[model samples]
Target: MPRPPLPDDVAELFRRPNPAVVAVLLPSGAPMSVATWYLVEDDGTVLLNMDAERARVSWMREHPEVALTALEEGSWYTHVSIRGRVVRWEEDREKALADIDRLSRHYGGQDYPTRDRARISCWVEVTHWHGWGAAKAD
Candidate 1:
């Protein structure tokens, strides 16, 4: 499917170094959210990393469905929201570590610390998305 449009402000927000906050719905009907480092791959997939034992990971394990939104800093009304499914998950320690390193370098311009190697990585396929901006009109 074609990717949705990202408002100019929202697109700029994703380019920053600050982590994006994603709100996910748990299988039990509750909501779980987290601030995660992410990368918008050239293929358009959004990659995320988290500890294997994190609540968001457990929620995804039981329910692959999730909603993600990128909030614009210092603004009350600009954001991008996406509803999607977790299409891939790798349990291989080495591969996950490698992916984390790749993403970190892509987003942070550096490699993942050895301490974070135990974390798991997830790849999300966006099914739908919408973006909006709220900057004052001059």
Candidate 2:
């Protein structure tokens, strides 16, 4: 099935480097969430990268379903929430590095500072989404 498109206002909000949190399911089916850097693709898919050694990476590999919520700068009430699954995993370390650099540039002005370690990149194919506060639909 085709994916649902993010509304224009919500998409615009995502284009900015806002604070985001991602939630993943644990082995026991409990949910764990952490702050993360993310980039939204034109097709509404979300790009997320993590340090290769993190436990969350293992959890993601074992269970692909995830959710992310991005909050507007200085306004927590205004946010966009997305539920999706990891539709693609970039196994190449070089490509993962590039992805981290891209995310770094989006969040900051320069490339990722730590280049000595491997990174894992995944693309979340958004299946459902909604916005609140200013981006909310009337």
Candidate 3:
């Protein structure tokens, strides 16, 4: 099986603005998951942003490993899951702000609703991935 982005069929599912849930490890090594907005970059990396004050930001900084499952909108069974690590963390509020705006436009068709809060962004380098349902690996 291919790693990370896989081929176009599986990758295509991620390109859409689908609902996604990201899972990360807590300090106790237990898994925690939260629904989040994500973007698939041209190079196949995943982009994610969060409020700087959120605990998940600190948790991700402490444990870079993460898994994201992107489900095709309106068709939950068709999905792709990627296991990856945070390759870069962007704390520059300006850059984070811009990235979040881009994500909001992709997901909600407008700029991020809140600008008062600082944002942080992370780039995930997918290491392994697989798909299920219509996107299932052959």
Candidate 4:
């Protein structure tokens, strides 16, 4: 099936730094989720970052399929859940750190502390999205 287009309102919602949770499939086929920071690219892909050896990253690497839910800062019901697959992985230290910093400013207001390990940047191509801000179906 063709993916849905990300409307302006939904795109704007993703621009904000809110609560985002990523779900990936483990080796055993079980689902695992983690809270993460993300950026929505102009091409509609979701940019996610983490330690090179993190479980989430490993799962995504091995499985490639993942889901992300970006929620409103103060409202749990206001959110967008995206189902996508990892389309690329960028492993440059400088770029990865910068990305985390960019994400930090969006979510935490500043920089991310302690960047000791190598970072992995995963770009997921969005295939589907569900829910809308507060209470409207988009």
Candidate 5:
């Protein structure tokens, strides 16, 4: 079946580097959540990046389920939570680096710092969402 497209407001929320968190499950069946940067693709899939060798990367590779939350910069009351899975994982060095740079520009004052560590980029398809304000659930 086809997936639903992200609404304009939810898409805008993701456009920001605004505070965001991602939760991935551990091998022990516990949840591991962390703050990070994210973006929305043209098809409404979510984009996230991390160090290629990070524990989260390993966990995600084995178990794609994830829940991500994004909150407005200045308001704690406004937020969006997405429950989904990594639909696409990209390891191409150039593409991965570019994605990180794009996210850095959103949150960081500049492009992501150049580093020797390889990067992994994941595209998440939104399966469900619950939020407030414009992102509010039906």
Candidate 6:
């Protein structure tokens, strides 16, 4: 499906130096939020990494549905929100390790060797995306 338009300020928030923090809703209706180094691919998918055993990961396992939002540090008014499902999760030990390396190199400014030492991680396939920013308003 075609992705919804991302508000200009929201887009800029994702383009910030620090990775955006996302809030994942648990099956119990509680929200588990965390800061993650992420990348938005040209295909309209947002990729994030977290330990498999983390609360959000556990919650996602039970309920793959989730919502993600990102906002600039100083301005809560400027932000983006995405509602979607986690369509894929790589549980293979080797692949998860490799993904962590790749993600770190891409977002952490580290070389391959340096990147491999980062935490193990998993992927979240964003099936739908919708966001807006206060900065985009008149």
Q: Evaluated with lDDT, which candidate comes out highest?
A: 3
Q: Candidate 3 or 6, higher TM-score? A: 3
- Which tens-of-lDDT digit does each residue in 1-92 have in candidate 5? 11356567666776677798999999897999999888887787889999888899989988999998899888867888888999999873
What is candidate 1's lDDT per residue for 73-106, written digit by digit as tens?
6663766667788888876376757777777787
lDDT of 2 at 33: 100
Between candidates 1 and 3, the one scoring higher on TM-score is: 3
lDDT (C-alpha, whole model) for all candidates: 0.69, 0.86, 0.89, 0.81, 0.82, 0.60
Q: How close is candidate 5 to the true structure, as a TM-score?
A: 0.88
lDDT by residue for model 6 (31-132), tens: 877777666656556677666556677777687776666665677666666667776676535564666555677766663453233343434556555544
Pairs clashing within candidate 1: none
- Model 2, 50-107: lDDT tens digits are 9888899989988999999899999999988889999998843766478888899999
Winner by lDDT between candidate 4 and candidate 2? 2
Clashes of 2: 0
Candidate 6: the clashing residue pairs are none
Best by TM-score: 3
**TM per model?**
0.75, 0.93, 0.95, 0.89, 0.88, 0.66
What lDDT score goes with residue 131 in model 4? 69
Candidate 3 per-residue C-alpha lDDT over 70-100 given as tens digits, one digit per residue, 9 for 90 to 100: 9999999999999999999886386648999
**Residue 127 lDDT in candidate 1:** 81
Quote the lDDT for 8 in model 4. Answer: 68
- State, as a TM-score between 0 and 1, how close model 4 is to the true structure: 0.89
Candidate 6 regions off by >4 Å? 1-17, 73-77, 111-138
Better of 2 and 6 by lDDT: 2
Pairwise lDDT winner, candidates 1 and 2: 2
